[model samples]
Target chain A: MIEFHLNSRSGLSPYQQLVQQVRHALRLGLLREGDRLPTVKDVARQMAVNPNTVLKAYRELEHDGLVAARPGVGTFVTRTLADDTLAAQGPLRKDLRRWLAKARLAGLDDESIEALFVSTFRSTAGEDVA
Target chain B: MSAVLRARGLGKRYKKRWALQNCDLEVPAGRVVGLVGPNGAGKSTLLKLACGMLTPTAGTIEVCGGRPAAGVEQLAKVGFVAQDTPVYAALSVADHLDFGKRLSPGWDDAEARDRIRRLGLDPKQRAGKLSGGQRAQLALTLGIAKRPELLILDEPVAALDPLARREFMQDLMEAVAEHELSIVLSSHLVSDVERTCDYVIVVVDSQVQVAGDIDDLVAGHYRLTGPRRDMDALPAGQHVITASHTDRQTTLVVRTDTAVHDPSWTVDPLGLEDIVLAYMARPADAVRDTRPALEVVR
Candidate 1:
């Protein structure tokens, strides 16, 4: 079972945070196909959050085809997101480490490096979509 | 969606003072609604009016499709936990349970006992000996075991420490999940409301400043900063809630239904706390001319 924790400082809505955490776990291979997600009541009780928030997050996941809720049973993961991208992570990690070292050696601070990476990442992704 | 609590021009008076006045509210069923405001904002008076502890002096108020406390059946439809989570100091925990069982027609003894067991409270202990958190939980148990369709709580956790408050909220949410109960809880803690409530009602200076779904309220409000300009020069769709200006720059919090397409101003979304604070900071009589009275938009 995957236990969820909330970061109040994250500035994301509770339901959005739940959705993101599930996606993060799926991509990290911590959750795989057929895994049962915690029931809405359990999550609400454990996290001290409204059950409707949990229900909304589950509905969004179901819409994305990542999970399915079976009547009178718990929700189950229907897809694994760790297939294609998992294979390329090693090379990507090496490249990212090398670039980070180069940036630090060039006198960029941690915040500057993060800002640079995030802006470049967003613009590149936006261009691809456009 | 049927309204669990509906009020139109509801007002209450005490001697020469109006505790709450000109209030209009329509709360939909199955929502955990947060009623937040400063002290003396009349949150308690409004809650008392809803549960029929106090009668309206001006207009009508309906709860669960009937007048509040109109009859035994009407009283059975709504449960209330008054301020400070009041419990009988002399009674034992079990005695309190018995009292609840004898009074409420829809009492659920098994559920109440199971909850008490999970909470680890001994039934033999007197209520006065319990900690503040424990006492609050005991009161909440009474409210829930009655199986009311709508539960109204007035500052239920204000006296407890943070940890106790968290556990109390956890139990409350679990009960809502199990019973599909609607809630209207008043509090001064915005962060708690943001975390546990789907709907929000901001009562400031004895009036409802704003009420809506939390997500909708957050999405529809924004903070804009740009060159100094007159408030009247703003676009028609952007209704300013609060504005502050320096000689060179103007900052405003606005509620707009449409997107802010103006390139000159830097617009950023606001968190629920910021939005509520902005409304609270506004002068009671200010901004009435700029926008119509804010209402719950379905």
Candidate 2:
């Protein structure tokens, strides 16, 4: 039921793109635990991709514990990760730390940074001002 | 990886012409192999012969260690998805499965149902009402769910859109992995082959121009661009697949198991598509003098 277009020109491989989209959906709570996924063939048909590409994405998701496949049944979203899961989120925390350090080094004061953050939020909230 | 399919001294002829001449190939099992060529290069005919749909005019072919044309056991172990996605248009998706269940001895109903549900396809949907992409999926479902040891797909994604094509290949790769099946598919799309296949067979001028694992083929073949020299003087191990000459230089694609470090030519790696085109571009009679070795024991 999730609808998203894969950008052919994107730097990410097709499998990575699918994994990102699915992760994004999970973050937004759009996809709940026990939610069924389209068959690899079905997604390929809908997106006009080779089934192998979808399989790759599904395999990644399965490896990440976000999805699980039943031999006689279809794949479904797994339940939420354990609290200790964050202990294993090494790459994500490293990326966040790097981005924050870069933002701090950009020479903006704390007040200016907060102001910039508020304005950025307002723009996405339907504000007319640029 | 055992030799699942073998073709020795295989040749085919039309009324007054030879389509494929003295072709020899041995394909290992549980690997994804690609057959590439231009139109009228006899790629489809080669697949037909492998599937036992057409009789070879000369030489012999064996599928899964047995003669394909002689019996149904070998043919049954081999599942063929032809150039066109041939399915019963009037039948429903469920009916197609039912027919497969009735006809195929090794049909896996659980796998078929799981795949169908994952794709969100209704069993009652008629094949004729399905879209082009859907028809292709259905054809694959039928062919793959039969649990054949060797799956031969002929241009299964050629008619699909770019996105659809990628998805179809992804699905195919997953199936190959899950079933542990050997696949030999034919296509003109190089990019698709690059992504999905590990082995390659180049068909040109009605013959198997070259066949090997892709990594080995690419690593072994070299494109040398430099001043012209007598190719007869080249070492015995270096076999020239194609040679093009300009005013002051000669560009040649050569196959050698050993590395060539000659100072006269700059040797560069060759792409699968480049090697395939080199063979397809050759004239039909150009290499007639180099007769194929015909000491096929099988």
Candidate 3:
């Protein structure tokens, strides 16, 4: 499932949030192609949004070929994007840069930043992955 | 799609008073439905029952198509933000987020953090010190971050100023559009409901007055205001839901989707609030043998 949230104080729309999160998750390899998302109702309920809103987002996703809907079954991620592209332009590189920016702003030494990033990355990725 | 919430003859009682009665409703998937009524109309009771926070005394209640009670696995699918957007006064905005992360198994911490950043809320600032609007925003954030299947908000922005209310509603609508979440929000303000919901359920005196698509209700229902005309003269297939009189003029609200090719009095379009108040003011004995003076839609 693509876990979602909405900020009543943010400039972004709820549909945008849903779209971004689902795509971000796909790019991060957190949600693989063929991963079935919660039903539109399910997403709506969880996110405090209208089902129409979620439907619009899903429709957009389907249009983008990022998700495939099976009649009477459910919506799932489709293996349309190449792994190489998924490995490159998604969240991984962006997340790394984000961590780097934070570390640099905190005035951390290069070695300290590297150690922190490696530890945090390992923890997030799982002990076995490390 | 499965019904996210179901109520059959579900009712609530408060001492000698009946808050809601003979209520039967099925909330289908993928809609932002609004619950509206006057104070003490049992709107809160209905929401509480749907959230499984209150047990019904008279009939069945279900959330996510199962019993709406404590420990029902389906409870995990419903996210409820109660009235007043309560939060710990002493906790920081960040602390509240941490609490949500710990308590809600489906909590999306990253999303919550990102939202906080996007909203420009000082996560480290004490929640008690935040303004009412900020508090409501935080409550909304927590509710949305849980990722439940149904989110029920009880007067979520009732405390804010007009600007704040508009912002809150806009934000909510945006989120609804983004997440496609089905929301059941309760409010006494029909204006808010009118702007935010496509579907509406009017709870009056602890009873469901009417529930349906706003467009259907509007297009199906008409306001006839004109010279006093006998109801019997009105065309067949029209059912009057409410009627009023002022000397020579009789105003009636009737539902006729087939179209009134010709009518006795001029028909008028009813705004959402007008229709709601019409039903809210419906007299117990309003349904009478005499046809209300019918006015033709011009």
Candidate 4:
């Protein structure tokens, strides 16, 4: 079972956070197809969040075709996101590590490195959309 | 959708002073609703009115599809845990459970005993000796085991420490999930409300300022910062809730159902706390012309 935790400082709503965490886990291969999610009551009791928030998150995931709920049973993952990108992660991690080392050598601090990476990623992604 | 609580021009007066006035609200069933405002902002008055503990001087209120506390049946449909989580000081935990079983026709004896055990509360310990958190839990147990359709709590965790507070909220949420219970809890702590409630009611200066689903409220409200300009020149759809201006910039929190397309202004989405605070910060006597028609209908 995948345990859900909320980051209050993240600015995302609780439901959004839950949806994102499930996607992140799916992409990371930590959660595979057929894995049952923790019950709404379990999540609400453990996380101290409104059960409605958990229900909304699960519904959104089901709407997105990532999970499905069986009446009287529990919600289960129906899709795995790790197929396409997981294979490329190793090379991407190596490249990112190299880039980080080079940036440090050039005297860029962590914050500057993050800002540069984010700006470059955004502009490139925007161009691809256009 | 049926409303668990409805009020129309509801007002309460204490002889010479009006504690709450011109309040109108409709809270839908099966949702966790939070009532929030500053101290003495009539949050308690509104909750009390819904439970029929206080008679309205001006208008009517309906709870659980009937006048609150109208009869034994109506009373059975509503459970109230007042401020500071009042419990009978002279009664033991076991005594309280027995009292609940004897008094409430729908009392869930197994559930009551299970909760007391899970809370690690000694059945024989007198409520007068329980810690604040424990007392709150015991009171909540009674409230929940009574099997009311709606549970109304007034600042239930105001006296709890941070850890105890978290525990109490967890239990409450669990109860909601298991029993399909509707809850109306009041708290001045916006963060608690943000995490624990799907619907929110903001009371300020003895009036109902705004009420809506939390998501809609957050989505409809925006913070815009731009060059100083006349507030009256804004688009008709944008209703200013609060505004501040410096020599060069005007910052405003506004409510609008449409997108803010003004290229010159930077629009930022607000968190639940920020939205509530913006409403609370609004001047009590601010021009009603700028205020959006109260959207409590939903």
Candidate 5:
């Protein structure tokens, strides 16, 4: 089961937030194939939202082939976005963390590190294309 | 889906003053519809009519496919908790539960007791001594225990503190799930309505200013900010709900399904609160002749 945390103040609709959470969970491996999702009624009651909102989110998930709903049973995850690149990124993540620690030690703040990463990445991608 | 509550040309009058007039509404099942308006916007009048508590002066209201207050079976299909969440102050909580079980047909005694226990309210406590929030919870329990197809709540949490209000709403959603019931909850708070309601009915000055699914309503309304431009210059599809202007620029909240592609304006989607308040701020009487399209639709 996936736990949905919605920020109503985030300017996105509640259903959209729910849909995104499911997708994010799937992408991050928090949710995987064969995991059951809570019924629309349960999610609505727990979140104190209109039930139709949950239905909409579930419908979007089903449309994306991330979930499948049985007639008498609940929705189940059928697919996930985790692929080979994501699965092989463990060492890359560890190295990036070490680099980030070094950058912070060198007095580069998070904003500067993020800016440097974006510009560097964009340039590298452009060079690859060129 | 079948509508649990339907009204056409629904009107109610007191002496010469019209409380509500020419209102047409259809509330489909499986929705928590919010009836929102100001104190004098005829929200209570409409609810009372649907509950069969008051007769209409000019129109008709039907609840559960039958006229309200029409007969015994008709009254059993819908439950109503009016403003102030009236409970027998003299009775103990246990006594109130007993009374509810005896009075309401299709009463679920175990469900009521379970809810009471979950709320952690003492059964021996006197209703008069319970806090406003507790009393409201008790009232809701009675209404939900009746197990009606549709439950009508009129500002059921207005008197509670913020925490109590939230808890009471939480109870409502739980009851909705446990019983598979549709609800029509009325409130003056836009935030509460936006949080819990899928459908909205905005009443302004004895008229329904707007009634639609909140998703559609929000998608249609927008705040367009741009350099000052004449209203006549805008396209016909853009029906302005409210407009404010400055020396250099104009901000208009308009309701339109058409895609806004105007290069000069920055179109921003309005939130539910903004959309509701926009219609409320500009009553039909205030802008009757200004827009023929709005009038015609109304």
Candidate 6:
């Protein structure tokens, strides 16, 4: 069973939040191909959202080529964000980790580093960054 | 799909006062539509009319494409749970379920029994002894098992504690998923509606302020804050729903999908509650600037 959760206070709509959660889980290796997503009825009951809202999330996921539904069975995670890009991101993560340690040693606090990261991230095209 | 509930020029007057006036609205089928507004906003009046409890003084209301409460067929198409979540206090839990089965031609006996069991309700316990939340559960079970094509609930969870409220709404969502029923739930608590309903109807001062799909409504409304300026300068498309002003600045909540081109105004997307509160806060006496009514795209 999917341990799904939603933050009603978040600015994002419920369906959009569910989509992002599935995407995040895929990226973090928490879910993968052939993994069955929780049924719409279960998520709606557990999360207290309309079943159509959950269906909308599943539809969007299918449109993005991340999931699919079988006639008699439940929806399944069909794929994740490009595996090649994820592989490519590994070394960049290592480099960023080392640079973050240096920045900390040079007295750069987390807030300042975060502010710098946000500004840089915002100025460039955000595609494939997540 | 055809509208499940449609009302045109609907009104109900009490002596000289109109409880609801010129309330033209349509609720789409198979959606959980919420009716929201402050007390005395005619939310109850509109719901009562939909259920055919009160005759409309001005116009008409139809449920499932037929006149509300016209006959046994019409009556069977709509179910109602009023503000108090009324259940016979003297009846035992099992007796209440049994009564519902006998009274409603379409009642699902097994489902009603299963709901009671799942709620951990004692079948032999009298309704008078059940807690407020428990009674509400029993009422909702009856409402759902009655299996009307549409269910109208008036503030069913208002008396429940936080956890109980969550459980109640969860059960409602589950019921909606399982049954082929449309729900029109009325609530003053925007938070409850925000979590439970997909469509929204905002009533204010005995009139329909706005009604539409929740996601579309939220996307179209925005708060624009900027330096002190006259309202007349805003573009014709930017219709103000409500405005608050200070000496140095003005913050106007407007309903429009047009992109804001002016750099001076900071435009922010509104959450459901913010948009609802803005509509409820509108001064009823104002001329309401002849902006077009929200198109009920049913």
Docking class of 6: acceptable
Q: Give one digit per residue, the lDDT tens place, for model 5 in A1-130.
A: 7777668587777778899899888888889899999987778667777677888889998998899999779899999887755967899999999999999999999899998897578456545755
lDDT of 5 by residue, B64-148 (tens): 8898878878778889998999988889999999998888889999989998999899999999999999999999999999889
- Kindly report which residue stretches of model 5 are placed more than 4 angstroms away from their true locations once superposed: A84-130, B286-298
**DockQ of the candidate models in sequence:** 0.60, 0.07, 0.06, 0.57, 0.27, 0.48
lDDT of 5 at B72: 75
lDDT of 4 by residue, B61-88 (tens): 9998999889999988999999999988
Across B40-130, the per-residue lDDT of candidate 1 in tens digits comes to 9999999999999999999999999999999999988999999999899999999999999999999999999998999999999999999
Residue A51, model 1, lDDT: 93
- lDDT of each residue in B8-125, candidate 6, tens digit only: 8899999999999878777779999999998898999888888888899998888899988898888888899999798888889999888888888898998999999999999999
Better of 5 and 6 by DockQ: 6
Q: Write the per-residue lDDT of candidate 2 for residues B169-278, one digit (tens) a residue.
A: 76787786567788899999876775567678888878776677765666667888889777797887777778888888999888776667576676666666677777
Which docking class does model 4 fall in? medium
Clashes of each: 0, 23, 20, 0, 0, 0
**Reference contacts recovered by each candidate, as fractions?**
0.76, 0.13, 0.15, 0.76, 0.40, 0.71
- Per-prediction RMSD in angstroms? 2.8, 12.3, 19.7, 3.1, 5.9, 3.4
lDDT of 4 at A72: 91
Model 3 Cα displacement at B70 (Å)?
3.8
- DockQ, candidate no. 1: 0.60
Q: Which ten residues in a row have the lowest lDDT in candidate 2 chain A?
A: A121-130
Which window of 10 residues has the lowest lDDT sum in candidate 1 chain B?
B287-296
Q: Per-residue lDDT tens digits of candidate 3, residues B23-66?
A: 87776776788999888888999999888877888989877767
- Residue B3 in candidate 6, Cα distance off native in Å: 0.4
